[model samples]
Target: MFELHLRQKSTAFQIEKRCKALAKVIKARRAPPWPCVPTPELPAKVVSDALIECYLRTNETLLRVLHIPSFRRDYEAVWSPDSNPDPTFLVLLKLVLAIGATTYDESFSLRPSAVRWVYEAHTWLSAPDFKHRLGIPSLQANILLLIARQATGVGEDLVWASVGSTLRIAMYMGLHRDPAGLGPSTTTPMVAEMRRRLWNTILEIALESSLNSGGAPLISLDHFDTEPPGNFDDDQLTGAEGEVLVPKPDGTFSQTTTAIALRSMFPQRLAIVKYLNDLSSRGSYAETLKLDTELRAAYKTLTRTLQTCKTPTNGPSDLELRAVDLLLRHYFVALHLPFFAPALKETEFAFSRRVVVESALRLWRAAFPVPLSQLPTIDDPLARVAISGSGYFRTIAVQASIVIAVELTSLMREEESLGLGPVEVRPDLLTALDDFKVWSWKGMETGETNTKGYLVACLVWAQVDAMRKGMVEEEWVMEVVKAAEEAETRCLGLLEEIEARGRQPQDAPFGTATQGVGGDAVVTPDFGVGDWDYMMSDVLFNTAGDPLSWVFQ
Candidate 1:
């Protein structure tokens, strides 16, 4: 009966009239017959086709059917167990590494099975004989990619041991050509955290290697080291032939027999001279003269060191840069000390101004070879001096302006005390102030919206200093108020632009600042004293203080 049914269904007229009848009979047979033609025996082609089908199929049952154990079993039979572990590991590791590199937004989800597969692969890599069993180069390369991902802030402690091993393997690879390669990944929070734990491991290896090879210290100096020096110095001096003078038991000078002993003892004698001078400086002219002499000596030493030192080829050594920085800072502090402050008056401020100019010029030249326009602007003048190539000239100019502003205010205050009254404001002072204003304004215009607040702060400081010195004339006061008003308006505009660009959903936290501006409606910043508060405080204090009280008394 089944054969008759099949024969009837096979008839061309019956097939055309009812194709469903043949399908039903074929379904009833449970499986295809010998004459029904067997599937092709190209295992590779079959596995490839099955994988493709598995990838394409969306239905749950179709995916399950395509993912049947038989396909993987066949694949394992052909390529597994006997193939070189290196190529196999690399091929699989590349796929695993791709998970982090590719973007996966809200829609995509990693399967638990996929995660398990990655964990297993990592476990295999950690095995003791992995280096020998698998080709080390390919394995090392893949391991580096894995370490990079972890260092780029991808994974946690769960895989950190693997990361350490990978880093060690990379070190073994003699890969010092790219120190900056690790920098980017090390900056990420995940990687940064991992690095904190594993840093000792890296440090141990680096230190050992560095010691053996006579390499530079791990914490060698950079340009930031070249900031202005602070308030102390201990001196060491030697005689012409590198001989040292020593002190006798009775405090008289004596020549030492051994060159090494003389070298060590000469510094102690110099310290005695410094200690005695510190005690003798009892707020008198001689004391001031002594300080001035010491400072001149120190300045000469610092400048000679800076001029004679070789510029680094790769980057400035941190110690060298810091030494320069300390020298500059000390020079400034020395100029400001009560004893040296009068030096400015004697030189008509020329000496002090020249010192500042020379220091700035030297810093600019030493740290950067590029044109000023290419340098980046930063907050610190000393930093600019260290890294002169980053559009830092404008920042230097701004710093110069600030120094001049403070000096002008001080001069105006002193003149008023001398009954010269508030001296008419100079065009130069006004020009410096205006340049600073424009610098800030340009920042805002260029979409550096965050800079507006900082500029406003600087302006407030200038204004406060002027007011405190009683140098703020009525016209100058009015100019400051107008500038503050303009700044406020600009800040409001920038806030609007920030909100517009954000275009966040109504429910999102960042977009909540989009509502309203000015007078009770605007949101106050969480921190910082605002521009208006500073200006108002200055006005209120100046108004409250009795200007005529001293004269009347």
Candidate 2:
């Protein structure tokens, strides 16, 4: 019995030794685990590919990680403590990566792994506990890092989408924090840069996608899901007493009073009436024209108050008030210009024009003034003819010139339809158009640089209209042609300057060559000049041919 026991013990010891050796070998063969060293050879392309693979393979794990309180806290502490991870980021990133990878290797594509990572990150960063622990600064940093890491060409859409979410969240958080103060340090710079980049990217993507698909419809703003504010509840705010409340997407609430006011001002719901009334009492008007006037007055009054009032530097909400007022003024002006023009009497038009011109002049002179030597010789016949001895008079003259040009163009078109060679040119109308053209061109060339484009385009359109009617004399037609040529030259030169400053290559010229009046080949000017294509196109087409013939149609 003793000998048998000894043999068993010996066998057991041998077996144990072999097992230990096998365990050691297994561990040695495995990857050096925990905080695995990031691969050094991983190019951006490779990393992107790996990410996609990982996402596909371990989407659940990534999602779980994202949801984890600790992980979210850490992420928020670095990038966006106050906001949730934007879901847009995931979609955009996937799309971009898919496109980029397909470019180099068709087989390389966004997989479940990438999706998983995105979900995980989102879950982790959104936990309430994590948000509280992470400060804004840390959160912003993390956001930047996240974008930097995943912002490859393939994932640009995702990044941009994420950026939009981040901005909304940041804005909400900032507003929540102060009710008035703009949010964290990253708010201004990040928002501005993202806006600019996103705009360019969106344009390029839209154009390229359209081109590639042989006119296939491109993605639109409607494709993306935008979160509406939770506070938007019209029914809850509406009352039987005819009060209305309008909830702005930006979180502000407007109230209106009176049945007409409620319907006209907040057509969506009667609940907005109270809000409208409240704002109106503070100078908001139900009628757009009145509103514009009120807003302009508010700006002027507030500015004057700020100049005399004792307040903190950039404080007392003066600048903010002024900005809001200006925005409102511009909004009303644009809204009313189309349908309400005929309703405005001659006196009203003259008064409004005077106000606009004087206000613009005041703003310009305060910001930038011409030197004595640079000022135009007002005594000259041309200058004297342009200005009717007063600013208000000059404004009327300009308005009259525009009206005459339009009328002549209309008459000429009618005459042509009747098979008449051309319409008769009234001397007074011709003179007015020429004078306005000269005056406007002078303003474009020598006035406040800020208003140069606006003045030039306005003048160019007037000239084109006159020329198209065949009512303009040959000399005046020549002048109009010269103006067009000069405008084109100036625009090209400006574009070149911009390209030089940006260190970007010049783009190819656009449009086809068409015969001019003398049968000389003149390239139909490209509409790409000076970021004012909307205005320029009107001038080019209205004068040259049918206005409706364009891609925009």
Candidate 3:
């Protein structure tokens, strides 16, 4: 079902040319680093305050690594003309600003500075004596740095390693245990609760990082005794040495509410991640179904406020809800992936296939709310950056597109083999693939994974287009060749567009680049044909013998 043999030499050449050009753009975008100042300076008070506010709205609820009232005091002090904040606290602040900058403006105008802050934080953390300096602020800094990396797509490949290291450092600090068990030294109620919050945040990051990298979760349910944090507002916690802390009920939508809710299900979430990623623990279909049942039940138990975004005035922001929804849906996709291919050929596994498609469709909608055809010719720069700047969202979109493609192709093959006439492809699947092709452009600079995803979406989209034209299976290759030519044109156009935008005058109020738009040097020229041919082959055909295998994995 996956084999492709280009019958026409001209068709083969067209496919090769377009793919090579697209590959060239991918390489060019990766050529230059953003220009950096000799001494990185913080933005003005107003801008810095805006960044922190943005961070609080977007990230704090999810991470729950800080006691906001305490952090705010340090935040104000750093900006005070008479005070010099500790170097560690400054690093933490910069990482927070970097994360905020991604969502601060629609055009991602602060992205260059965001990248610089992450670099500076990395430099500080890499110091030989940094381990000796690890504290609550350092933990906050490291976690924020991980988040900032995901937002900016810098050091993305190393996130799994970085998260693992952070988890170990956290364990070293004894955060893996409940502070209540640590006796008089941990008697400060506010300090004890913050420790729990930070531990939960670290474990959650470790699990997610493991899922993203397809590795074993660094820590398991058995590894930690830290309790879920209270669903209390940061202001409710007094730093007085003997003050006792009390948590509000689950129905109350405080800042730590989402974190607490997620923490409540951490054990089940960890189980899902570990079972899916650990080869030795691979289980039967029945076991997978059982896990699925538990997951669904847990999801249903999530508070109504978290389950819906209808009342944003008293609950989590629409952004946070969408993010949480996508994450929960992703677990469904991951769980059923191993059986997705089998379900196409067997009746017993049909539920797996259905679950995969349903989850993917929901994810696509959450990631790109508008239909592809309805998207404006000149896209909204803010919406574009918000979606593209997030590595998590981009990954979801690409994965969803792959599932849509697989389902679309399977339907075509069934119709052809059964001589049942052309089957109408689902409209949502068609729109999703189209949107995914465009979305893939924003990620070209991040490198090979996205470029490969773009190619798959392009090829599958071509096949769907051909099917609509009543073309038989044998003629699909030629259509792919045609589509490849268009894709090359589109790729070049998008690259030119990016360069043009980079050259535009700065208008964002928060920050501006002091150097050229494309960074210190111009983008590199197109790579040779042979290099691209190798990339295509490496990506599309692996040892598994299935072209779609990598996408599923």
Worst 10 residues of 3 by lDDT: 526-535
Query: Stretches of candidate 1 above 4 Å error?
Result: 1-292, 306-331, 334-401, 410-435, 438-472, 499-553
Residue 379 CA displacement from its true place in model 2, Å: 29
Write one digit per residue (lDDT tens) for candidate 2, span 63-155.
Answer: 111112222233222233243232223222333232222222211222222223333334434444433312232233234323322322213
lDDT per model vs. reference? 0.33, 0.32, 0.68
Best of the candidates, lDDT: 3
Clash totals for all candidate models: 23, 50, 1
Clashing pairs in model 3? Answer: 106-382
Candidate 3 total steric clashes? 1
**TM-scores of the models, in the order given:** 0.29, 0.28, 0.82
Residues forming the 10-long window of minimal summed lDDT in candidate 1: 58-67
TM-score of model number 2: 0.28
| Superposed Cα RMSD, model 2 | 30.9
Off by over 4 Å in 2: 1-135, 138-167, 171-174, 177-286, 289-301, 310-340, 343-474, 490-553
